[model samples]
Target: MSDPGLPPLSRQHDRRLRQMYRSAGWPCQDTVEIELLAAGLLERRLEPSGREYLRVTDLGIARLAQALDRNRAALDAHEALVLRVAEEAQRAGRIAYRGLGLLAKPGERWLQLRPDVYSIRNTSVEDYLEPVVHEIKVRRADLLSDLKKPDKRAGYLALAGECYYVLQQGIAEPEEIPPECGVMIASASRIEVARLAPKRPMKPGFATWMVLAKAAPCRQPLEPEPRL
Candidate 1:
């Protein structure tokens, strides 16, 4: 299959991903398992909402046919973490939190934006759902004193917007930083549009889906005529 130019599906092992997906299904929370299962990528028997815990089906070999190489590798690394964060957040019962490696669009480009860690909480659901976005810079205590320049802030925000990320978390913690550029969580929940930081200039790459929206037909192609 041709490269979708998209990131890998499962960065960590499959077991970890399943655990996170299952945890997201708790009461009054949103989870991606339903959508993924609907895509036939996951198989499971979910208890009725507010009932028993659901069972997850092991990934079938057939799935490998469609998964990208990066996605497979991601499952080993960041993808697993995405699930871990979701589960941990839900478990902690925190009202606000950060999500990494989620799909977002800035201008035309569809790049992966991973936040170091983001936290959000509000007095009520209404406030939590407001549309807003913000760019954050994490700094070490030593560097924090000197690196408050406007250019740095702008640079970080620009990078965030380019990746369609409204939130940024810079963990200068000696141990928290990863060796690579970064890792983004595959799926996450958005609190509210009003909560995301104000709109900024978008970068060019893959056009934002909204701009590209059109009345295109969704149909399967017909097979070519068989040789006589």
Candidate 2:
């Protein structure tokens, strides 16, 4: 539970947080939009194009000022990219999330390597399951640092049906990545597929299937019915 005085922010609040502040163009599924409106944090106004716009309000600013500490706890660059990419993938029918929907084993050892982020398309046997894995690289040094680890390559290739390197825009060029892997840039306002990842299934172990079995639409079951 959150402190009585603190503005409500926790793991349960991620969807709400993103709903209230993500780009107006970004899709929202949670009731956070409505809550923000009720709290006077957001106003439902029309854009020049006649589309509804949920712009922040002065009262919302005041509320946010009181939530400065909580906001700081909630926002971070690495997770921000993960959130954007995950949300985008969900929109595209990808739901299973690493460390979320995709759970690690009860007593896992160093041999099992988890992708920074990943999603599964479907779980049905006859249907082909698309496993998309992403390695979030916020800093060039972090990217270079991981490059030295040979296991990272072997791990991703064995688990991901399609692999992607999700980096901040201008952080690295698409040419830096191989033709098989895709390159996605997380821009300030949006996530762009700078390069499409090629599809290739890698034979995975039983541990991998365990993770895929848990794939669902979004973390919030009541939210938008995941198209997945």
Worst lDDT window (10 residues) for model 1?
177-186
Give candidate 2's TM-score.
0.55
Give the alpha carbon lDDT tens digit for every residue of 1-228 in model 1: 113553344523344344545574332223444444444445544565636443433443344433455355534544344334434434434322343333343345444453433322223553342221222322233235424433433333444332112112343432332221122222244222212233444332233223223222112224479999
Each candidate structure's TM-score, on Cα atoms with residue i matched to residue i, is 0.22, 0.55
Best-performing candidate as measured by TM-score? 2
- Candidate 1 local lDDT, residue 173: 33
CA-RMSD of model 2: 16.9
Candidate 1 accuracy as TM-score: 0.22
Task: List candidate 2 segments past 4 Å from native.
Answer: 1-75, 100-110, 202-204, 212-228
Which lDDT tens digits does candidate 2 get at residues 73-186?
434777777777777777776564744333223233334566767776644552466777888877776677776765555557666678899988877888887666789988
Model 1 alpha-carbon miss at residue 180, Å: 18
Error of 2 at 102 (Å): 8.6
